[model samples]
Target: MTMAGTLYLIPNTLGPADAGAADPLRALIPDEVQAITAGLDCFIAENAKTTRAFLKLVALQHPLAKPLQEIQINELNVNTPEAMLPQLLQPLLEGRNAGLISEAGVPAVADPGANLVRLAHAQGIQVRPLVGPSSLLLAVMASGLNGQSFAFNGYLPVDAAQRGKQIKMLEERSRKEKQTQIFIETPYRNAALLETLANTCQPGTLICIATDLSLASESIVTRTAAVWKKQLAAGKAPDLHKRPTVFLFLGQ
Candidate 1:
């Protein structure tokens, strides 16, 4: 019987290629992770274009096992049907090692890749997670909030009235459970979300805005709702336009 291939869970940079250090890949990705990524020829990625870009960077550090054109990259998105999961896993079932990569940060968490990971497990494929940066964990660690118990509440509602109500609900839940509530917003709507968070949450509630994690333009600030309100009034809110960010709050 042929041995099944192992599935490697790879992580990509949090933002644009040049968003971070002079050598972003060297700085953000460990040597081992780069080496492993460079050796994989089969991958499941959110976007083939971005995966090729990531591979080019990895190639700079460690030469790829096969040419870029020869590598097989399959796309996986939210709209992918449940019945097609097995087909995506065919490479592994055929004894070819494959990597699972996300558009940003780690795979599976807050990504459609989670479905593939679950399917891999059910099919008895060995899944190995590589070490890398995660915006959620980085935000929680720097928030000065209750990291002991926290939850990542993906993206909040976009509508102002509905979002405000959802924010209050999350705040209330945080207060009762002494848990930190974490979420994100569409980049363009970040400023609006910050405004709503400052205005809707209680005065003493703490909110941490971590933007561009692992990037040169990174910013992580934890302040009370009252203080944030004051900043907003003074037009001192950080510029979060078109930047990836993670928002966390803990109600007192």
Candidate 2:
């Protein structure tokens, strides 16, 4: 019987394709991780095009085991059907090592690759996760909040009133549990979310907005809601529009 191949959870660069770096991977990805990524010829990715782009950068440091055109890539995203997971896993079951990649950061955290990772474990396949940048963890580390006990709340409501209620609810939970609440927003709505966070949360709540994590333009700021409100009032709010960010808060 053939040995089941291991499932490698590979991490993509945290920045965008054109993040103004000569080589984004060189700065963020460890040499060992890049070498492992270079050896894989089969991958399951959130976006095949973006995965190929990431692979191209990996090739800059270590030549790929197979040429880009010859490598096999399968797509797995939010819309991928549950029934399609087995088909995607077949090559691995048949002894072909495969990599799982997210559009950015590590796969299976906020990415849709979670289900596939679960299925891989159910199949008893060996799973190995490589070292990489995770924006959620980075934010928690920089927030000066409760990193020992923190929770990632993903994306919040988009509606203003509803979003406000949700922010209050999260703040309350943080206050009671002494936990840090971490979340994200659509790039275009980042400023709006910051505005709402400042307006809705209590005066003493600590709000940390970590933007462009691991990139040259990265910024991580932790301030109380009152201070944020003051900034908003004075029109001194940082420009967050159309930038990738992670928002976290811990209430007193």
Candidate 3:
């Protein structure tokens, strides 16, 4: 019987590469993650290009024993066929450790990597999640909202009316159940989403906007709808345009 290799869940940095910066991997991503990542030559990633870029950064810290070209990266994305998922674990079945990486943050959380992870478990492969940054957890932690219970809604409806209705429903649920409602939007549409939130939610509803987390330009602010509206009126609100952000809401 062949021993199955462990499947490591590796976390990638949220921002672009900065070779000159101090601790470019950020504070939360520990040395252990880098060490573990260095050992794995096969990776299943959301995007092969970005994953290779991340590997290069890791190589900066720990030189790769094998040539960079030798490293195998299998791409996984939303449109990837479910039938092809098992192929991603072939390395593990062959007694070679494999890494699951996302474009940013932890894999399998908001990423399609979850499908592969689920298959790994069903195949009895060892699934190990390394310590790393998660935008969802970070936002909830800093939001000062109900961390005890929170829901990640991914992305709300794109239509204006539908989006407003969805926002109102989420707000109502948050208030009634005392749960934190978390969601995200395309970076470009962030400002519009904030506008919808301000219009749809009650004045006392608490909204947390966490953007560029773990980066030099990181910003995390929690304020009521009324307060945020006041800031908007004064042109003091942080611009979320083209910035990766996590939005959390809790009704007061």
The candidate that wins on lDDT is: 1
* Segments in model 2 whose C-alpha atoms lie over 4 Å from true places: 17-24
Global lDDT scores for all candidate models: 0.92, 0.91, 0.90
lDDT of 1 by residue, 81-161 (tens): 888899999999999999999999999998999989999999899999999889999999998999899999999987778
TM-score of each: 0.96, 0.96, 0.96
Q: For candidate 3, what is the TM-score? A: 0.96
Model 3: ten consecutive residues of lowest lDDT: 20-29
TM-score (C-alpha) between model 2 and the true structure: 0.96
Model 1: residues with Cα > 4 Å off, grouped in runs: 19-23
Give the better candidate number (1 or 2) by lDDT.
1
- lDDT tens digits, residue span 23-59, model 2: 6577678899999989999999999999998898888
In model 2, which residue pairs have backbone atoms overlapping below 3 Å? none
